[model samples]
Target: MVEDEFATEPFEVAWAGEARWFLQFLSEGAGEVSVRTQVSADGLVWVDHESPALSGPMRGVMTVPVSDFGHWLRLVVTPSSGDPSSLARVYLALKE
Candidate 1:
């Protein structure tokens, strides 16, 4: 189960036409998980995107779209409430 917060590797997305993040929880035992779409100018300082934060059940997948996010992108994951994530994965998709 995930106890601490999670952050994905910084991605430079200057050429990508579209970007989306998929977050999944492997088990139903864990509570809800939340994800924030963040952007950075230098890959260090990050701020939330205009998109709404993602939060939902622990057994399904939640997706967040990103746009106007400058050149750098990443995801920050955390437990929405209750128990932490039993098993979780975050995937980023970029369109050409």
Candidate 2:
């Protein structure tokens, strides 16, 4: 189940040897939103795993592979034309 909440900061998840992850975003307002996947070994320093995973409308689902990723993963969101209140809910799931 997804614990619905607005994303005010980078949302992080611990890598538990999952082969893939799924991210879902639902927006309440109209705007351009960018969501990028980042990875870090120590969880202190992070690097972008790929190009902007999702951009444009803030509502969609993204699938991320963990083959070359670190032990930690996160989503860095950048929204234009809207504030943090524009985000309605976010969900993440893991697949082995």
Candidate 3:
């Protein structure tokens, strides 16, 4: 089902040199779901990363990489703009 805008919990990754987000869409309804990588310092507030926003189609997957971020990271997912409905998963990969 299409969901309202949401954000993942702030994750502390100050030790990692790089991070990757894997967005997999298992099923979709209408348009598509867009994802934005966000960064935070205190893990209480957030702002978007410099990379462009991304979206995935039904049964498709999209990946985004981020670096130069501070101590915290998260993803803000939105289902507006005539976009998707349900069944999407997110994964984060960090490397030194």
Candidate 4:
């Protein structure tokens, strides 16, 4: 799900008040990109992570653990390309 092409597709996760690691698929050569995992208490206000869960060129699978259940979770990617579609080449998935 491509969000803005220039920015990145953002996803929200709702946990049932349990600690779990949120996993997703990632691709390489998408361009200079970074992945940010943020947590929200009420799904309204969000607190950005101190650092990106994943950064630099993607190599393989990237994993981000949720220390605690959050009302909301979001992931973002930064594209090097000026065109949005070009940045939308990469894909992320929730594996079974």
Residue 76 lDDT in model 2? Answer: 62
TM-score of each: 0.88, 0.60, 0.86, 0.48
Instruction: Pull out the clashing pairs in model 4.
Output: none
**Ranked by lDDT, top first:** 1, 3, 2, 4
Instruction: Please list the C-alpha lDDT of all candidates, in the order they appear.
Output: 0.81, 0.54, 0.81, 0.45
Compose the digit string of candidate 3's lDDT tens values, residues 1-96. Answer: 337888988899999999999877777556666789999879987889888888755447778999898789999887755546667788899998
For residues 4-89, what per-residue lDDT tens digits would candidate 2 score against the true structure? 22232443454344545455555444555566667776777778786446655545664555555646666666665544345344
Question: TM-score: which is higher, 2 or 4?
Answer: 2
Please estimate how well model 1 matches the true structure, expressed as its whole-model Cα lDDT: 0.81
Tens digits of per-residue lDDT, candidate 1, 1-96, equal 556677888999988889999877776745677788889889989888889887776777888988888899999887777777477677889987
Candidate 3 error regions (>4 Å): none
User: Which candidate leads the pack in lDDT?
Assistant: 1
Which parts of model 4 are misplaced by more than 4 Å? 1-30, 50-52, 80-96
Q: lDDT: which is higher, 1 or 3?
A: 1
**Could you tell me the TM-score of candidate 2?**
0.60
